[model samples]
Target: MGSCASGTQVPKSTLRSGSRNPPFSTRPDLNLNTPWARSRSSWREEEPVTKPSRKLVGKCFCGAVRYEVADEFVYAANCHCSNCRRTTGSAFKPFAGIEREKFRLTTGDDRLLIFGEESGHDAHCGHCGSLLYSVVREGAYVHVAMGTLVDDPSIRPTAHIFVGSKAKWFTVTDDLPQYKGHVT
Candidate 1:
């Protein structure tokens, strides 16, 4: 009809009678005949996304005990005395003091196991015990055990030293700053 509109003959009842207008150029078809783009062909999907690697690593609880904390976390506490609730049975005792020269020992410091015979010395993991902390007898300091950090020591407690031997059924309504014993 007019030499079939000069080329790509738009005649099949005008391409099914203009199924609601289309036919604008050689490429302007993002609407790609809809239906979610005809079962997806190039809706852009190289599919990769995977970022989460701050390079933190921890062990113990069997693994013979390994450790690494290149940096981050200068404080993070919970304490609550009574010898930190009979040596961490819990009711407080988060700790994570850092800086005893950045703490290392990439694997079993000779099967690391200490446990205070006199004053304060914890440090566990003799093959799956896992405590890893306590050394403060003015030994410059070292008290990890913030649940054996490996990241999550984002930090929050700047104070709360002993709270008069705390644990009278655990209570601390949070306003921080509450030392009743040693804040030094």
Candidate 2:
């Protein structure tokens, strides 16, 4: 676990209240600090814009990492890449791509373990190790783990990506288009 702090999550009331900003402040860009807990210059920050009337909520398996996301999605796909399979323990990982600003960590920001903390990385629960989402497109978008979402989103996987590297034993029965590589 990459967690250096306790897994306890701050309440919504105590956290920064607004539509554009998430309650948590570990992100380096936001620069908002919880005087009692976190400070500036911590982990990465996801850019969230204005709030919407409806939002989707998701959490890790152990209920340690909780988040809220805007219902809008840029794209959604099922990835058959080896890394996606290993992380989700499935033949493919069904994910929804949305802007970073649309997502917020409602609780358990300190409990997140980021893998490949660079241009793109996978955010997992430090405690239960739940694969939550992957920051991609130079950290501009998040391929959110659909399995973690508690509220249904408006989008669904319209295609399969990385089929060339997909598991040999698993068969794709769906009629959705299968791409040998990433969708263009």
Candidate 3:
């Protein structure tokens, strides 16, 4: 008996008698069979999908130290610097950069040892003396030892850093970008 906002006269027959809810029209233009007409429960049943959380895990050689990173890496690089070579005992240190917040120590927090000053530190497992990661850029990034990773990050080293300090015995075979010093 009342008119809708569109100025169409809402016939009393359109509404169910004694019902407080709005009128349910039988108009063809309403298309009540469409997806928009389905109830919330019905809509969910039609499409059910869930995304799994992504986690990249790593551990020390002796498994004394374990850590995990969520989502994606910030960057990856093979550092040929003397410091990395000396610490890792390798020709080059393949490392991946991750945000500090996303990096978590799952265990062996007490057994973790830090070398160097607060400005820069190489974190390792005290028990097995396994180099885990280096806290660099004033603690803004964690340079994870790629060798320690148990899961693939799906990212490859973009460049070779500090090639000037690369060991003479080792030769870089890849065509990745090389930097004489650290990449800015």
Candidate number of the best TM-score: 3
Ranking by TM-score: 3, 2, 1
lDDT of 1 by residue, 126-183 (tens): 8777777776756555777767766665566677788888878878888878888777
Clashing pairs in 2: 47-101, 48-101
Q: Write the per-residue lDDT of candidate 2 for residues 3-49, one digit (tens) a residue.
A: 21344444455445454333445433443456533533343233455
Cα-based TM-score, every candidate: 0.33, 0.71, 0.73
Off by over 4 Å in 2: 1-51
Model 3, 62-156: lDDT tens per residue?
99899998757889999999999988999999999987888999999899999987768999899988889999998888899999899988888
Q: List the residue pairs that clash in candidate 1.
A: none
Model 3: CA > 4 A from native = 1-53
lDDT ranking, best first: 3, 2, 1
lDDT of each: 0.67, 0.85, 0.86
